[model samples]
Target: FFFSAFHCRGIRDDIEEEDEQVSDAINVSGAAPPKLCTSFAHFGFDEQLMHQIRKSEYTQPTPIQCQGVPIALSGRDMIGIAKTGSGKTAAFIWPMLVHIMDQKELEPGEGPIAVIVCPTRELCQQIHAECKRFGKAYSLRSVAVYGGGSMWEQAKALQEGAEIVVCTPGRLIDHVKKKATSLQRVTYLVFDEADRMFDMGFEYQVRSIASHVRPDRQTLLFSATFRKKIERLARDILVDPIRVVQGDIGEANEDVTQVVEILLSGSDKWAWLTRRLVEFTSAGSVLIFVTKKANSDELAANLTQEGYSLGLLHGDMDQSERNKVISDFKKKNLPILVATDVAARGLDIPSIRTVVNYDVARDIDTHTHRIGRTGRAGEKGVAYTLLTHKDTTFAGDLVRNLEGANQAVSKELMDLAMQNPWFRKSRFKGGKGKRLNIGGGGLGYKERPGLGAESSVSYQTLFLENCIISSIFLKSERKTCMMLSHCRIVASAAVCLQPVALKVTANQPPELWGIACLH
Candidate 1:
């Protein structure tokens, strides 16, 4: 199974037959949940290791870590389902360190004891850095190997006896094929962002790499979304793993405020983006997502010409350029970077305060992943997406997703949705007559009623100077009748054949004080 740009899809439809086809859930009991983690002391971590964790500013264990760390330490396989940026990396990292450090030092030609596989080079680097910190405390060396990196440097690092190896599937397969590195002693295996790996069509390579590892190794799979497809992959790899499910699957980050702007035309998209950069974003780093690799560079060039500081990250660039752009982004020097879907999956940039979908993603999953780039590590973020007529196919899903995330959907966007047949059929009923948009702009009425000439009344009010009338048949020089606002009705039976304007009286009728006015 391989992914191609033409299809813009994930894995092949055919699910490869597995050696064992057990698809049922397997539960393992480990440490109970703690409402809050005061310190790492209660998790059975060494005093030296605890110092590193504390120095890293992880004062308390996040929910995933609180339960996941203990289970991983128990030497049980784990399938952790948590939202992105929920500290899942640290969850497996902490316990994997404990296991690796307990083992004796590796010989000069020996293999790594722990192997962590991620979908992209950026993620591999991130996980590798974390492992290095904890491993360094106990003199356990770790190395990161991924495609686009120097093969010689990676092979030499492996030869030096790294206790832990964090790498992507394709690069790992290359090293294994060349006998540059071996997974013979790998006791702890982690698949971070497992769904993304499968999405990129790395199943064959992942399984091929797995063949080199010991069968008794403890495997762990962590995914932001626990979809049925992800579950199938988990069944294939894990052995009766402990299932730790927390948070809504594929839900947008709570700290992110999502927005969808339906444009009248494609040309308006750039104008909207420029306006947003100048007005929508205020103080934080911004990430702009484009639909294609070319758009990334084009948008970056245009924005840069406009005096905004930005860089580009896409698959078309050489690994060196991508790394430099990522480095610049991390350093906050290039606060705004235009990127393609290649930058979507788990690239952590904690200071990103906003994400702009210069081109709205093709699917809701893609949109969620793009928006996830911001609001990472519990920081607040806002995402602005520009939508056009071409993306009508996804309008229904986009609206529901925004509403599901508790974000406001614009009335104009909903009005545009009525034209979409899918939205009209499936989403019309429950959503009808519900217009929450108040002052931003909109007539505010949910439905538009057609009126014939005889049934219609024209409103012509020049002034209301101390004059009160529940029912008014005002006659101007040109217009004949006046209609009440919000469908207020008139009780008078007689029609005003000859309309007359009312004059203001200084004093209100005494009886009016007791009666509430309707008009």
Candidate 2:
């Protein structure tokens, strides 16, 4: 029934998929899979634009581009899912540019013909800069609208005319409400990092701005992860959109190595992290994410005092200050940056060798993006972390993410997993017991009397960016969203580990779980 609404006239004979095994995640109903292009020329890009593509050093289409560009160029609405740093921006850019070029020439000081909305200021500028590269080849006007810059300049740029407007939702909403920008002529709408925009509490603003756009416009939604909100939104607006999932919906990127260390107390964190910083200082550029704005300060100071170069970034900093920090860090003048979650999702820098979680992230999505800051564009990178008692409460999600990243799981983590029925069930599903149920709804595991309520990890809470083992998300009227903080178990619980034939009895004691051994 769903497939009947989609038209199949967009398939081109020139493009050919490279005999790739399609992921089971992609669901196109009856439509044949969109043929992936072997090269950019297969899509019939203009010679001048192709010149710009090469001058920009793009040799060929990336995976997301290979799959997404063809469908997009076919003039069909699309929902593309790929991990961060996967060249997603270009995937959508090529098609949007082609479509714009096909139409009558846009005049300066005229309403934009296309709108590309994203979640952050950094990403907005990045997309706009990229658009200009291709748009300029055809003499198309492109501008970025975001907060923290001169509103007068942005308003003037919009008034003077631009065919492409890459903007953040909040500022764009302000512009639309103020009558400074017009979207009446917009025929192309893109929600880049759609999941992150919703995650950041921009749903209402996005929907409101989207309401102002013409319904006949072609829409494209791209995201790294898909939550229920994203799925629901897609259903409401996208008309039989072609779903192009480049990778598993929530699968972790394989380019980064995840490392975890057990920290017994707050006293140990500074000393432990400082030693790592000293050793890693010369290795490459680094980004350290702390949970609180205040935490960024203390970590930055300690690192500087320890003779390591570092910069700080947080929500409280002024725009100019933040820009300077990011600029210095990217310039390699500041090799290390201590930041809060504000910098987690968007800000892409070059050659960031490692991402340090000085403070444990609030959720699995946060964790996924934090690690994504490094290991971009297929470069090898590392995500180092200090796991404390407060954080071990999420041992299930943490362990699965580590294992998914192909890191060596320590015995301590394995023991923590042993105590978690959710972890045992998911982490060893194929090898161990079938799904177990206790009472009416719980897992068949005895809860330690000291741990309070009995619970199991909500399998439904697992996101496609499959780093998280399990989670339970709750909606809030005021806060937008919050994940359940209640944990299944704690350290005092008894555990026994049987790593293959290397089995250890419960009599060996839980404290011994921390001892090092060959995995």
Candidate 3:
């Protein structure tokens, strides 16, 4: 019942997929999928909402919006799985505006008619801005409540009577407890970046928030990546919800040109950044993502010393300061910004032309969101990830994502990925107790005596990429695999050997040959 659709952007179609197959059709499951809405006009939205959409210059509904909007309008719960920057915010927000308008106006002291929860404060603020932009025609009063800002101010705004509230989990919970706001009136509930919320350990807070909302509320959960935990959470919250999946989860954004650079070590990143800093800055706004808050500050200080006027943003900064930095970066006053993953998820700045990963992300999901900061709203973007040997733990997944998006995988990065201990274990499926004959003096395979369970080389085959193994058996320097010191290579005139067979592993590519040599 699942149908897949590609993000209708300038994605490359000519590149042939040689690894795992990636489908372009958007998948919709659960009951009958709602009819896809080709345009905003199909929704028959309020005139004011239509005007705001037109003013936003939306040419057409995105893949997620096409299917998600209709499902949401049906008043059924929904789980939207799509790549980042695929208009997921609007997929739920548009329907939410329609839902809000249909409901009676909020009485004094009543909480928001719709409550949208996000993972980060930045995302909370961004969604609140969207609520204001689109809800203006209906005279909607939306307030953003999140941590880092003054609690008194947020409480005052909430107490002033808001029909829409966009906020983070902790802050929202605080307001609910203090009686500053109530979820009793929230009929339209949204969990934006649901996976991220779960990742940040907000599962309890999210469940707590949802518990306060009416059980029959129309719930929407959207995310770029989904996990088993998220699925479990969805089951607990949503009822008979239709699932709309656009593009592959954890797949790299095809609209962004991804480049991976293998460095000698982590320390070399500064030099690499310095070399391209001016070029990237001159082109357009650049966002440099680091792993730690200290890294962001240190990098920003170094760049400042080099006379580059850049902004620094991290969790350590105060909310007001961070807001100013984001504002400056967005307004083009600061062309360069050094930040941690705090700005990675949902900071929608169209001016971000380039994203440089000063440190490799810890996981594929985080990496996906980090690069997603650049390529947004159908604009072409470029992202560069600087990797060292230490970061090759996730190199295999990175290579797969890159290949899945038809992005170029550098030979250095590919080699490291293959050599990585984790990748090797996955590739060979934990080579243990398996034995194959290694040729000695003769060209044909012969069972060597006493080469059974106790043998050092227990693996049956060895995988080689684009390497040439001659009659001379080069020592197997790979730490993951055992060396076949007992066997000797015999030169033969016949190119093809006898019964010794070769086959490709399921996770690996066809070109990756698994061969047991005459050694």
Candidate 4:
């Protein structure tokens, strides 16, 4: 079920303008002292630290950074629940870097001071990159350790004495067990995307790694959602830490427009999907969500065979393969990526314009995370769900849960379900099936051989031109719809050749003259 409350415009401009005015009024009258840099500046950070921030082009601090940075700098534990892409990485990294830089020099055999554990290798690499960028001016050293790569290289980096280590739980634990790296002297420990790690069944590994770290170290936990499990885990790890909750859990971004299309089992989901792709032709990139890894793989294969530039990612894939797929997808070399839940967590891609749930998720939490992939960083995004009869109950449960969270389902979506057929057998069991016979042509559009007298509007012929244009311009949505709409308008216009002029009069909205002429 699509929810109206899930659609939000984010930080209303009017409210922001009002706040700016109020702030100016207060400042002009000298009613309050300017907010001092009581946070980082008070911590005795060197000039190099400030210079690094300036070089990184960071103009202002996010709320997490503003509050959590100081506390973490003070060597206190912290638990933060902020929305994805809220600059949480920097919040933890900056203070950690400051501490490392202030140490001036380490003993000949002193180990790393901080160890940052992320759920995915991608996130581990991302965190490592950000740390390096921020620590560049201070000449601080950092290394990323994750599976799917040569351990030799990572060990070499570790042997060189990195002050900070960003790693995935499993790989880091491997190193710890081998005594290749030691966290005995580490002063700070961070669990980034804590919920995802638990969901991915990394609890044991994370706990094992944590046990190796000093118990007296400051522990920081950051996640988008804080369920009972996450809260309990935080309690076990953090010591009387400050809690900062910036957004509601499982809340969809307001800037995303969500729609649900109910379809019968026999209905061609591919056709419906093709139509939606056309509608969102101008969107930068699209992520299609499927239930199983096999389905994601098959879908990507079929789409690619149909001439669509596509990529596939799933847990079963090797780390190197997954990294390549993600890299290609992010660079827009592959416009579409079929993926499972693994890609849904802590993967920040700002250019994703749309998300399509080819199959409804089994649970509300999964649904929330899938759609949350788009509509990031204050950008407008769209999400569509292709629903079938078998998914009704699951969809209903999801809507009910959202309602409980103050998000109401859209009545329009519920009504839309009635028009679609619901009970057709799935083409594939567990989403494993042969690729459909989508003929190859320019821009994923194949021309059919036969044309009849009554075949006035051939989707193949009409869409061929549109597809070429769309592919060249990256307009998948427009390609899907332009042909159909053009055919309808052309047929109607052929019936009457009268000069019909649409006009917008002084005070009236524009009126369509063709409809009157049709009558």
Among all candidates shown, the one with the greatest TM-score? 3
- After superposing candidate 4, which stretches have Cα over 4 Å from the reference? 1-57, 400-408, 412-519
What lDDT tens digits, residue by residue, belong to model 2 across residues 1-519?
Answer: 432312322221111123232222232321323344446655556677889999988876677776677567655567887767778888888778866765555555457878999987777877888998888788888989988878888888888888899999999878777778788778789998887898789999888877787665678988876666887777666655666654445545678888877778878988887767766767889899999977888878877777887889988887789888888998999989999988887678866998888888887667878888888877888888777765645666666556544467789776765676766765476532111210012112122223224221111111122121112111121111111111121111101111011112213443332322222
Q: Scored by CA lDDT, what does every candidate get?
A: 0.66, 0.66, 0.72, 0.61
Model 2's lDDT to the true fold? Answer: 0.66
Tell me the tens digit of each residue's lDDT in model 3 across 1-519: 532335211121221120012123466666544445444555656577778999999988787876787667656678888878899998888877767766667788888888999999999999999989998888888999888888999999999999899999999999889999888777789999988898799999999998887654678988887676787787778765677776655566889999888899877988899999889988899999999987887888989999999999989888889999999999999999998988888999999999998888767788889999878988999999888887766777777678667677788987888878766676587432111100001111121232222111111112232222222111122101111112111111011111111211123442343343542
Clashes of 4: 11
Model 1 lDDT tens row, 343-415: 8987888888888888878666677788888877777888888888777767666776666566787887777
TM-score, candidate 1, is: 0.74
Query: What is candidate 1's local distance difference test score?
Result: 0.66
TM-score attained by model 2: 0.76
TM-score of 3: 0.77
Model 3 lDDT on a 0 to 1 scale: 0.72
